[model samples]
Structure formats: structure tokens, C-alpha cells
Target: MSALLDIRQLHAFYGKSHVLHGVDLHVGAGEIVSLLGRNGVGRSTLVKAAMGQVAARGAVRFKGADILGLKAYQIAHRGLGYVPESRDVFPTLTVEQNLLLGRKRNADTGRWRLGDMYRMFPRLEERRGVAAGLLSGGEQQMLTLCRTLMGDPDLMMIDEPTEGLAPQVVAPVARYLLALRERGIAVLLVEQKLAIALDISQRVYVMGRGAIVFEGTPEQLRQDGGVRREWLEV
Candidate 1:
């Protein structure tokens, strides 16, 4: 798998408070790489910076082009999708309407369609007529994930996708992510659930104090308890 999104010596800040240190990470084409850590370790910040939602940077290259200084929408149009920790859904819109908003106008429908999203998470199809705000937390999450996919992004950076879901809800979300991988979409997942991340990802990166502390295959990470205790464990 070749590199799809690459960051080298990346640093990010929020106003006066510096957050991410010089971090280095990459996600390969059609691969799933989970970014794991405890809360406030700058896991979200890293993805935000890469998506051009934050300030400061070193190198953020996606598909061999320098995407630094571009706006979020600009980066998104280039095939890098970002779903923030906040499930940003239009409350007033119907589930299908929200998904329609994500469709790129005048562009070739790449990989995702309304049917694809609905097929992946059948609950979305059932609730297509409902307003987004009326849905539960898990349902909103499903809507958000599918909405982003409707844009047909090649690489999606998802932040804390399973944050507040029940176990039953989480299982399908995990399975949907696997389904995305099968469809040749690379995922940069910011995940709090270590088990799901390890189970689905080919590789995992452990973040500590705004920097990458460990990067290895899931099996390698499973064998290394010290890295987990220092960077990931509660």
C-alpha cells in the first residue's frame, strides 16, 4: 500500500496555547490506521490540522500535493474527508436531505451513493424520512458517517466515532468501517475504544503529549504492554 496521506514534523496550535508537538504519521492507500490515546492527547488536533481546520504545520501532503494553508472545504474537495468529534448534523434537515448536502455538485459520483450508505447501515434507510435532530446519539453518528461518505472521499479522518454508543450500536459502526476498507477507502480513525481499533486496523499509532509514541501493526502493539501503559491505558 502506497502512502495516501503523509505528515512529517507536523505541529498545531490553538491561539496562544500550543497543542501538537512535531508529530509524524502516515496512512496508506486503502488501509485503516487508528490513532489511539487517552483524552486531550491532541489526537483530534492532529486530524484537524491535517484537514486545515487548525493553524500551524510542517508538511501535510495528501495524494502528493501540499494541502497546507487550504481551507477545510478545499482539502475536502481534494478527496480527504473529515468527520469531527462533534457529530455536526443539520438538525432541521431530513436524514436524506443531510446526505444530499454532502453530494458534490457537478462532480462525477465517485464511490458512494445514498444507496451505498443506506446499505451499509440499514438504519439510515429506515430513518431517511426523519429529521436528523430527532435521532438518538448512535443514530446521529450513523448519519454523520454516511453523510461524509456521500462526498466520495478517498481517505476519511474520523474522530472518536464510537464515543457514546451502546455496545450493540458500536458493533455495526465497527462493521461499517470494515466495509469502507473493503471498498478501498483509507481511514485515519481517532478512536477511544482500543479493542475496536486493534481489531479493525492494520496498524495503530499511540499518541502521548501531542506526539506519536508508538507505531506498529496490531499484533506488535498487542505484544508491547509498556507502550500501552505509558500512552494508552487509563
Candidate 2:
């Protein structure tokens, strides 16, 4: 079967500084893949390049068509959702309103719904009328996930969902991602937290200096301490 998303020799630049060099990756249908890397390794740049949020020179195929030069909104319209590391949520909008903004009316109708989001994140339902800025970090993270789910994306590229959260908080988020995989949504996560990524992803790709250096099952990644130390251990 063809990949749900395919990127070949993807190259990206920020002004004149090249960030991604000949990066290649793919995500299959209903698969959970994680990109592991330390800071400033172009993981986030890969995500932006895939979503057309950055200028890139490479082939980015989503679903079936080439999406290299598409606008960010166009990419989102094509059933791709992105949750950046910053967790871009409207500070003044109420919790419900923030989620409503994520609703893509033109998207394919699937299992995702406001009720599903509410069930997945009970905190959102509880603070339906509260301002988004008032929520805690974990709550905001949950809200960010819910907001992306609202778009009903077939594929989601999430960057660092557990960056600043406590271990207890990361656990539930990991569980939520696994639940998403069960529901048949392809997730491509860029994460620094190796344990969380390994626990939730079916496959892993270790990236360094803007290129993918290793790809394997989670168990293979764990057993190779040398590779881990070189690319992941901080």
C-alpha cells in the first residue's frame, strides 16, 4: 500500500541557513511514528516543511498529491493537522471557543467530534466557558490536542507534546495518542522524551543534524545505547 505521507530528500532552509538536508521519511496508514532528536536538530523544521509552513526543496506527498508549495491553510484543508511546540491557542478565547476554531467544516466526517474531544479531555468540558490563558500547562496541552482533533485530521504532526509536563501528565497524553492510533489516525510525533515516544509509537526514527540517522522498532532503539547516546541522550 502506498504511504499516507511520503517525504523524499526533503530540504528546508531558514533564510540562508539550511536546516534539513536530504531528509527522507514516511508514515503509513493507521501508523504511529515518532521522530526522536535532541534540541536544534531540525525535527520541528521537518514538521513545518511537511505542512508547507516553511519554504522547502523536496517532494512532500500527502495522501497522494505533492504538497511541497501549498499554503499552510491549504495543507490543513487536506486533512493534515499540526500542533507546534508553542501550543498556539487563543489566549482570550474561551475553552470551547478555542476548540471550535479547530473544527474544520470541510473535512471528511470521521469518528472525531466535539463530544469525543470532551470525553478525551474532561477538563475542556469542565472549563468550557473559561479563558484559555487561565488554564495550567497540562490543561493547555490537553486543549491543544483537542483543538487539533477538532480538525478531524487524517494525519497529525505533533511537536513535543510532553516537553514541560510532569511524568504523571505525560502518561495520560501518551495514552491519548495510543487511543488515537487505535482510532486509525496516522500520527507523526517529534519528541525529545524517548520513553514517551517509545511507549506510544510503533516505529521510531532518530534524527541528527537535519537528517534521519536511524529507523527501527522501539525495542531496537532501546537496546542500542550507543546510538541513543550519540543522537538522543542529553
Candidate 3:
């Protein structure tokens, strides 16, 4: 069967600085695929290139359509969601308002709603009236994830979702991704936390210097310590 998201020989650049080098990756429907590597290996840039946030060359096919040159908003319109490492949120807006901003004009056709988000993270519901900026780091992260879900995406490329989060928030975030998978939403996770990623992901890819070096099941990744030591271990 064809993949939900397929990227082949992908190259990404920021100005003259070439970041990704002929990378190839794929994610299947309802699958959780994790991109793992240390910093500066172009993990973030891969997703950015796919999202059309940077200049890139190669084939990016989403749901059998070529999406390489599409604009970022256009990509999102195609049922593809992106949550950057920045956790970009409207600080001045109330938590509820921020979520409201994420709803597509016809979001009712999608599976998610404010009630679902509230149920997933009761803290967000409790602080629904509070400004997003005033919330804790973990709370802000939850808000960002929920906002993206409001768009009702078929596939989500989430970058560094667990970065800088407190220990207590990490497990819940993993569970959140698993829940998305259960709902048949494919996820391409750009994550640094190996334990969480390995635990939740169906497949894992290890990157080194902008190229994918290993791709296999989480068990294969765990058994191969050399890849972890050279590409993943801090």
C-alpha cells in the first residue's frame, strides 16, 4: 500500500546553508514514526521543508498528491498539521481563544472538538479563560498540541514536543500521541526523548548529518546500540 506521507531525496536549505542532504522518509496511515537524532542534524528542517517553511528540492507526496512546493497554509489545508519546536502560541489570547483560532472554517467536519481537548487535558479546560502566556511551560505545550488538533488534520508533523517540558508532562504527551494514533491520525514525530519516542512509536529512524542512517521497529532500534551510541546517545 502507498504511504500517507512520502519524502524522497529531500534537500532543504536556509539561505546558502544546506541543511538536509538527500533524505528519504515515509509514514503510513495511523502509524507513529519518530525521527531521532541529536541537535543540528536537520530533524526540524526535514519537517520544515515538508511544511514549505523553507526552500527544498525533492518529492513530498501527501495522500498521493505532490506537495513539495505548496505553501505552508496550503499544506495545512490539505489536512496536514505542523507544530514547530517553538510552540508558537498567541500569548495575549486566552487559552480558549487560542484554541478557537486553530479551528478551520469548517472544522465541524473533523473528529476533534473543544470538549475533546478539555477532556484530554483538564488543566487547559480549567484555565480556559486565562491568557496562554500566563500558563506554565507544560500547559502552553498542551495548548499548542490541542490547537493543532482543532484543525482536524489527517497527519501531524510535531517537532520537539517534549523538549524543555517537565518530567510530569512528558508521559501525558506520549499518551496524547498514542491517542492520536488510535484515532487513525498518522504522526511524524521529530523528538529527542528516546525513551518516550521508543515507547510510543511503531517505527523509528535515526539520522546523522542530515541523512537517515537507520530505519526499523523500536525493538530493532533498541537492540542496535551502536546506532544509539553514535547517533542518539548524548
Choose the strongest candidate by lDDT.
Answer: 3
**By TM-score, who's the top model here?**
3
- Estimate the Cα RMSD of every predicted model relative to the unseen true structure: 1.1, 1.4, 0.9
lDDT (tens digit, per residue) of candidate 1 on 80-185:
9999889999999999999999986443646777888888889989999999999999999999998888888899999999999999899999998999999999
Model 1 — which ten-residue stretch has the worst lDDT?
A: 104-113
How does residue 77 of candidate 2 score in lDDT? 84
Model 1 misplacement above 4 A: 105-108
Per-model TM-score versus the true fold = 0.97, 0.96, 0.98
lDDT (Cα, tens digit) per residue for candidate 3, span 1-234: 469999999999999999999999999999999999999999999999999998999999999999999899999989899999888889999999999899874865779989989988889999999999999989999999999999999999999999999898988888899889989999999998899888989999989999999999999999998999999988
Q: List clashing residue pairs in candidate 3.
A: none
So what's the TM-score on candidate 1? 0.97
RMSD of 3: 0.9
